[model samples]
Target: MELKTRMDGQVAVITGGAQGIGASTGRIMAELGATVVLADVNEDGANATAEAINADGGTAVGVRYDAFDKDAVRGLITDVAGRFGHLDILHNNVGGSWPDRDLQVLDIDDDTWLKIFDWNMHTTHWATTAVLPIMLEQGKGSIVNTITGGAQVGMSIQVAYGSAKGAVSSYTRYVAVQYGRRGIRCNAVNPGLILTPHAVEVMSEDFKRSLFDQITTVRAGVPDDIGYAVAFLASDAAGYINGEAITVAGGGPRSSHDAEALRVGAYGPSVPAPPADLILPDLH
Candidate 1:
């Protein structure tokens, strides 16, 4: 059966929509008939994305500002509500740090930790807080956030990034539980090593290859994958799936280095595994 995803006359605001997964989501939502507002710090890139949507005969506009700014978020919510009279969806896709800067727990500094928290966790916190009032007024809405496997499994050089993203996942559930009764749904999309423009600029070919090779599917992810998931969660199609953290990874390596023995004994001996206390499991 064919599924129809018509979002005609709806209004959406997407943070970090200038490029990467956020930009792709904006384009997809606009094409599906929503009035997309591309919010980002990069004016040129934001305008370019809006222009592309316009050229495609979709409704879109650019709102340039730092998503981390509380004032900016408040103004954004007010503007979108005043213009469209209601907000149906909000996608929070900002916040990422370089691997070098994103260090392990002991190696990271206070400033770095705070910066990551503000950018990743606080972006979700403030944006969602500011938008909830408008959504409550309308009595229905969806908010999608970006997270990653690292947030749950814990990565070597992503202490700050992982910790902040974990907060996003936790907060997503909190929002859903708090507002589901009020007709709002909140969820998250955790993208793996997607080859976004920002990622390509920072990651070496060898490093990128190693990432893909590590995946069980032997393939890296792309922005469109994340975009598709965002669109689904934003649409009424996902009305029943609130407080979910949907991974966009191609079912990443089921075994970490310490769990390699489990692969060898698939149907044989029961291999010793890491204690459940060590690593967080995927939310069932």
Candidate 2:
């Protein structure tokens, strides 16, 4: 017998569903017969995603809104529930931080920090709060937040982003602990470097090739990797999995011991050093 996905008749609201993992997850959810609403500030990207899903005979809708606006977030939740009659899944894929000047903690201006905070953490809170009532009324729901590997081990440049994502990781557990009895499941997914259209713009081919060198899998993660994980956690198959932080990096970074082994010739394999280890999962 063939196994099937368990999202039939469900409705999912995915923020930043226009590109990358969010787009992939939205498509995956729709393929499983879920009504997906693609919400993003980028109207064009959202419409494109909706078009692809519709073309594939899946149900989808596109909505445009700035995630930082609490009112907009609340309205989105209300609209999705009203239109679909029920809401079952929520994917919080928004949040990004930069190390650029005026955004750093020491020298960064107040507005910049606040903006980053709002973008990375506040948006997630707003979206979650807005949907809580509906989820409570239904007595069952799943929420997945996107986090960063940098937050797990701490990277130098992405201070704000890491801090924001760290909060998400913690909040995932908090949500799960507080609401598990209420039948609401919350989890976080930390994605390694994924090759999205946006990423391709900033990364060179050689740079990407270098990133694959350090991982045990010798491959970088794609959007599908994260999407598939979210799908599993959102379904009844993962009914028992709540408050978990699933790292979606492929064969994450190697430990210093492995590096030393390779250095000391104990490991016969001569591995090519990747140009960038940032893209590798947190195997380290």
Candidate 3:
């Protein structure tokens, strides 16, 4: 039995749909026949993304939404469902690291720590909680959360972001377990070293090199990689893949020591070659 990825009769609400993976995912969902609702704090960017989708012959609408505000989130959900008559998919994709402020727990102040949590975890909670009733009433829905590599693995540098995302990862599973019997499915995507426009602009050469060395692929991940994963999880084909986390990272994690060694060209003395007289076995 083949399940089509095209969502002709479905409507999708993407929270971070202004740019990067959010924009890419919106385009994909729209292209697949979904009526895409792009919600973002960046009104201009969201409108641009939606306009582009419309130009490409896809259905989309852009609106201002701040996921941290519970009341506003409810209104956004209501507006989207009201317009389309049904809400089928939601990509909880709003999150960003606090520059210079994403610090180790000991180094961070209470204000900064709380801010990061509000940015990452609180937004997810607001959106998911607001959407649950609608999904329950609809009797079917899918949610895809955007988490971080720091949370997936362990990194001491971004303690606050990592901790918040860890909470979201757990929340993802909780939603799945609590609602799977009710026809609601939830999953998360952990992106590693994706080269979004903002990353390209802000990442220093040293930082990029460090991450590139950690990933097996010479190139970094792009927004489309994550977009495709989100689309798949939202589709009926992935009905059984609930409460799971798909790491769209290019490869397995490399040891930090190895990455540093390669970065600094500090490999220890090379091992000597075997004697020429030694005959190697060939039992093929």
Who wins the lDDT comparison?
3
Ranked by lDDT from best down, the candidates are 3, 1, 2
Between the candidate structures 1 and 3, which one is better when assessed by lDDT?
A: 3
Q: Give each model a TM-score.
A: 0.87, 0.89, 0.88
By TM-score rank, best first, the candidates go: 2, 3, 1
lDDT of 2 at 160: 74
Encode model 3's per-residue lDDT on 184-211: one tens digit a residue.
9999998887778877778786676566
Total clashing pairs in model 1: 0
- Report the poorest 10 consecutive residues by lDDT, candidate 3: 275-284
Q: Over the stretch 1-284, how does candidate 1's per-residue lDDT look in tens digits? A: 43546688899999998888988999999989999999999989999999999999998999887866878877887888898888889998888876777788888889888888989999788888989998898889999999988887777788988989999999999999999999999999988767776666777755654553345453467788799999999898887899998888866744455235444565467534333332222210
- Candidate 1 local Cα displacement, residue 86, angstroms: 1.1
Off by over 4 Å in 3: 1-3, 258-284
Off by over 4 Å in 1: 1-4, 258-284
